[model samples]
Target: MPVGLMLVLAVTLVFLDLPLVVIVLFSFNSSSSLSEFEGFSTRWYRQAAENPDILAALGLSLTVAAAATVIAVVLGCLLSYAFVHGRRRVTRPVEAVAMSTLVTPELATAVGLMTLFTTAQLALSTLTLIIGHATFVLVYVTVLVGNRLRTLDPRLEEAAADLGAGRLRTFATVILPQLRSAIAGAAALSFVLSFGDFVTSVFLSGTEIAPLPVRIYGMLRFGLSPEINAIGTAMIVLTVLLGVTGLWLQRSRRSTTTSNPL
Candidate 1:
C-alpha cells in the first residue's frame, strides 16, 4: 500500500510538473510561438534580454517582493515572540485572524483589500501591492517563526539572562541565531509568493506598476510567446537555486549544532 501510494505521488508530481518542463524546453525553441516545438535555440532568451518592458516588470516584482518580505519578517517575528511568550492570551486571537486569510479564497482577499484601499483613499501602486502581498505572507512567516520558537528551549534565554545579557541582547545573540533557518525559510517563501503573485498584484497595481506576473499574464493572453516560456524557465531556475541554498544552510546549521553540544 505504501509503495502504491508512493507511485501515485510520483505520477502526480510528473503530471503537475509537465508544464514547467515544457516551458523550459520551449524556452530554447527556435520558433517564436510555444505551440511549435522547433529545434533548440536560445533566441527567446536573447529576445527576453532585449525586451525593456520585461526587464522593468521583473525589477518591479523583485522590489515589491523584497519589501513585502522585510515587512512580513519584522511583523511575523514580533507576533511569534509575543505569542510564544506569556502574552498568548492577547496574540492568539490576532494570530488566528491573520491565519484565516490564508485559507480564504485569494480573490476574496484581493477584493477586500481593494475595497479597503479605495475607501481609505490609498493610491494603487507597488506599495499597495506590497501591503496586499504582505497580508498573505505574514501568515506563512508566523507559522515558520512560531514553529521554530516552539522547538527552542526557553531555558537558553534564561541562561543568557543569568549571564547578564539584556533582553534585547539575548534575543539578538541567542534567539535570532537559533531561528535563522526559520527566518530564512519564511523570507524565501514570502519573497517567492510576492514575486509570483498575480491576483493581488492585478488588483493593487496602478497603470505604471505592472509586475512580472502581470506582464506574463498579458503575454499569455495574447498567445503562447516563447519569450514567456523563457521567463518561466528563469523563474523556475531561481526558485530551485534559492530552495537548494536554503536547504544547504539548514543542514549546515544542524551539522554545527550536532558537532558542538554546549
Candidate 2:
C-alpha cells in the first residue's frame, strides 16, 4: 500500500475505534469518572453482573437474538434457494421487496411494524421484538446466502440429481455443504444485529421484558454509570468475537474448497 493511503486508513480506523477503546478502558476505572481513569478495577463488571435488571435484560436479549437468528437463517436460506431455482416471474418481485428492506430506514420499519401490530391487535412483547428483528434480518441472510448460491456451480446439483438424489437430498448433500460458511456468517450477523437493535426493541418491547440496549438507554435517564460502560464493553467483545468467528469460518471454507476441488 502507498504510504499516504496507509496513513489515511490508519487514521480512519483510529477515528472509528478510539471511542470504543476509551469505553473499554474506562469500564475498569475504580471511580465513576468518565473523563479521567484512576486505576484498573473490575468493580463495574461486578456491579453490572449483580444487578437484577441488567441480568434480566441481558437474558432477554440473548433469547430474542437466538430465536430471531434461527428464524431468519431458516427462512432466508429457503428464500435464497427459491430465488435461485424458482421461476423468475414470481421470484423477481419478491426479491425486490426483500432487498428494499435493507435500504429502508430502520425507524420507519419499526413504526410500520408497530402500526401493523396495533391493527392486528397484537401486544408489544418479546415475541413481537423477535418478529420485528427477524423480519429485517431475513433480508441480510437472504442476500448473503443468495450471492453465495449464485456463485456456485449449478452442475453439482444436476449431477446429484443424475445420480438419483432427490431435491431434498441434493440440497442437503451438495448445496447445504457449500453454503455452510455463508449460513454461519448470516447467522452471526443476524444475531449481532438483533442483539444490538435499539430502535425496534424500544418500540416493540413490553413491560415485562426489555433487551439490554433498551435497559441501557433507560439507565441513561438516571445518569451515566461505570456499570453501563462495563456492559457496553461486554457487548463489544461479543460482537467482535462473532465477527472474527464468521471470518475464520469463511476462510476455512475457502481453503477446504481450494484444496479439495471436488
Task: Output the lDDT of residue 169, model 2.
Answer: 93
Off by over 4 Å in 1: 1-3
CA RMSD of all predictions: 1.9, 1.2
Give the local distance difference test score of model 1.
0.87
Judge candidate 2 against the unseen true structure and give its global Cα lDDT, from 0 to 1. 0.94
Residue lDDT tens for model 2, 1-262: 9999999999999999999999899999999999999998999999999999999999999999999999999999999999999999999999998899989999999999999999999999988999999997999999999998998988899999999999999999999989999999999999999999999999899677889999999999998888999999999999999999999988997898789875
- Cα TM-score of candidate 1: 0.92
lDDT of 1 by residue, 6-38 (tens): 999999999999989998988998977657786
